[model samples]
Target: MSSPVALIATAKLRREDIDAFTTWQGRHEAAAATFSGFLSSDLIPPGKDGHDEWTLILNFQTADQLTIWQHSAARASLIAEALPFFIGGNTGQAMAGDTAHDTSVTGVTGMIFSRIKPGMEGRYREWAVRIQAAQTKYPGYRGIYLQPPATSGKDATWTTFVRYDTRAHLEAWMTAPERATLLEEAEEFVDNMELVRLATAFPGWVPVNATTGQGPPDWKTALLVLLGLFPIVMLELRFLNPTFSAWNMNASLATFIANALSVAVTSFVTMRLFVRWFDWWLFPNAHRPADTTLKGLILLFMLFIGEIGALWWLLP
Candidate 1:
């Protein structure tokens, strides 16, 4: 199972009151633990954008857990204490929570895009690699992928990918001198630019074991068996014998009908087996601990229903 994740909740704060907000944040973390479903939290200050705002990224076992924390008295008190000093506004206003799909990532993937000038694409890539090498050398860098310009439209763009032990580490990386150099070198290629700090927390299902292993026992296998038998059964009941009277035909018809009925009955009986096997083998039901296992199980069951009932029809 992947680790359950949450978003980096951002809010702007006065630079003078940063110390005060930091202190309050520590207290809030302690207070938060008292609430049900608490996992962990981190404090991130403003980086290259050069603002006084700070961001707090939190993680929980599930959306239900976050809902509980939001309404907790401690959470209310903490927000009340810290709201007055923010610049981008308060947590309850600018901040919104998006549930994560990839529980593998502790926090969301934040991306910033910079475009290259017509002739500077080659040099821009050179600087990008240097920045990436520096970034990869750093503790939190995951890996980077660069998407060059497609044949049709705008110039090429550059992206950087970094992982953080905490959001604080990420914020620090952003503000570091190497990033400043990257930004400076980037200006040569860039004309009109855009930066986006995204939160990749939307939820979805993913397959578990794709390679050699005992796969899940589900209706997929049973359905395959039924499909294979369909042609053979039709031939046996309807076309095998050439000589037969009307009464003989009626008896033969009865035997054919009985065989079809048995097949349908067996498929219906094994439907649950299919669901259980698929749910267990496919989705990230084990990402959280055993105490939260039931919630994951329920989520997987819903996924199974959607897949077998709706998705099958929708897909080609």
Candidate 2:
């Protein structure tokens, strides 16, 4: 299923207000948790650029809950409390999906922005279903997402998203003769078509350069993920095993839940910590080749040493 509806907002913080802002943020999140349909939230701190901005991503189970929370007195009071910490007014965008919009670019994703011909909605949808099925045969195909026109809108514009593990894989799908034929098939149904790569700032453990609004290369992302996840998983396994054993729950289900929580912690807390610690390697001439590659190799070597040390110290 898709992710819950969410309001994603970012505040430019006063340099001196960082601590106070965090305190208020924590309180605000706690309040939000009390609301119905509240699922999860994450606090994204500024990057190496010293941007002084913090992002709050809040998720609720439904549009109704999202609206209620937006207009709730609790939320209003929290906003009023946070005003002094803001260097600038907050900016927000509402989105719904399996993951937050910013995080969706962890892989190479393509957006197909199209408008249907008037009175052709029925046929266009049929065509879309067929194309979606065709795409499943492609290698590395992750999934497709569809966003219809807003409520009560006449224009039949549709935003369709497709994702694959790598740009090369995505390109293969796009440039394939099969895809070309499919586009020809869809030409009359779609009045306008635009394809572009989605750029992202931060997704998860991967460092997406803030300045460029682009994610790090795949190798860098993989290595950094390993750097963070290796220790996190190991430590969780070592310390959490006893607690899991004590639980009356089925062992398989217990293990699954424990691992899931471990990953959630790694995504929301652990990665942010490493991003700050590895800022130098992540953002240095991020656009240039060899620069990041060389530095990533160095960090990877360090990670190897850290991994060995962790196993020695944490393992029985």
Candidate 3:
């Protein structure tokens, strides 16, 4: 079977057009949903005081299905309708393989677009490999995905997606003197460059630190999610399931409702309360003491045990 494919589309819009652009994008997404093999889509807006570029990622079961959507009249019409809101024409590239379809990707991603000077593609590619190798030595480095311009000919823009474990770690590499030297070296082979930061993956699950722009690590976040979710699941299985059965609700419908409630409660209530109480542990300072970590783990463990004990007692 073919690997799943993700189409990454980017557009630049003026500040004044953002509201109108978002409305148009909603319609565009609605149209895309009707197409075959559409798995999911994520629209990432620019950050506060950040650049004007908006990114849309559409995941499809196969590249063929994505190609159909790309060439469909519905998409073309929507693109035309959206032209007035765009500062420039949009650009898109289809990415396949492991990195593109990596569902577990979290933290921050830097999308770097570089335009190579005429006749310098070969040399620029060699330099890209070297810079990627250099970046691997940095702390919290995840991986990088590179894509050349979707269409051939005069457009020589290369898109590079570099992911790091956190915003602080990403910024460290971005501002490092070694990277600056590499950028300076690329002056001969590069004509222009733009970098956009995307802090997505699991939005609204964990609040980012204002100063660091970093959230708790994935493992910590997952553990907290389990801490909140376990009781919710147990309670629903105990109380909600019986009530639904008494009401004669369809099995599928009950499952859907249960999931919706789980997500809503987890995102809005449980996570917010837990995050507030665990703020210090969640967003520890760079030099956080070992005891701080140990204490936080002990507290979390105790909470889990208490929840289990109470639920076991009450459920029966």
Which candidate should be chosen as best, given lDDT against the real structure?
Answer: 3
TM-score-wise, the better of 1 and 3 is 3
Instruction: Give candidate 1's error at residue 252 in angstroms.
Output: 79
- Which stretches of model 3 miss by more than 4 angstroms? 1-201, 286-288
lDDT of 3 by residue, 204-236 (tens): 666654333445677777778889999999989
Superposition TM-score, candidate 1 onto the true structure: 0.30
User: What TM-score does structure 3 among the candidates reach?
Assistant: 0.40
Give stretches of model 1 more than 4 Å off: 1-7, 90-316
Q: Could you tell me the lDDT of residue 83 within candidate 1?
A: 76
Ten-residue stretch with the least lDDT total in model 2: 204-213
Q: Rank candidates by lDDT, best first.
A: 3, 2, 1
After superposing candidate 2 on the true structure, give the runs of residues whose Cα lies further than 4 Å from its correct spot: 1-207, 210-213, 286-292
Compared with the true structure, model 2 gives a TM-score of 0.35
The digit string of per-residue lDDT tens for model 2 on 179-263 reads 7677777767676565645433335455443223345566655566677777777877787876777776688887898789778
Per-model C-alpha RMSD: 21.4, 22.2, 18.4
Report how far off residue 151 is in candidate 3 (Å). 51
What's the lDDT for all of these models?
A: 0.49, 0.66, 0.73
Clashing pairs in 2: 3-97
Which of the predicted structures, 2 or 3, would earn the higher lDDT when compared with the native?
3
Q: After superposition, how far is residue 258 of candidate 1 from its true place, in Å?
A: 71
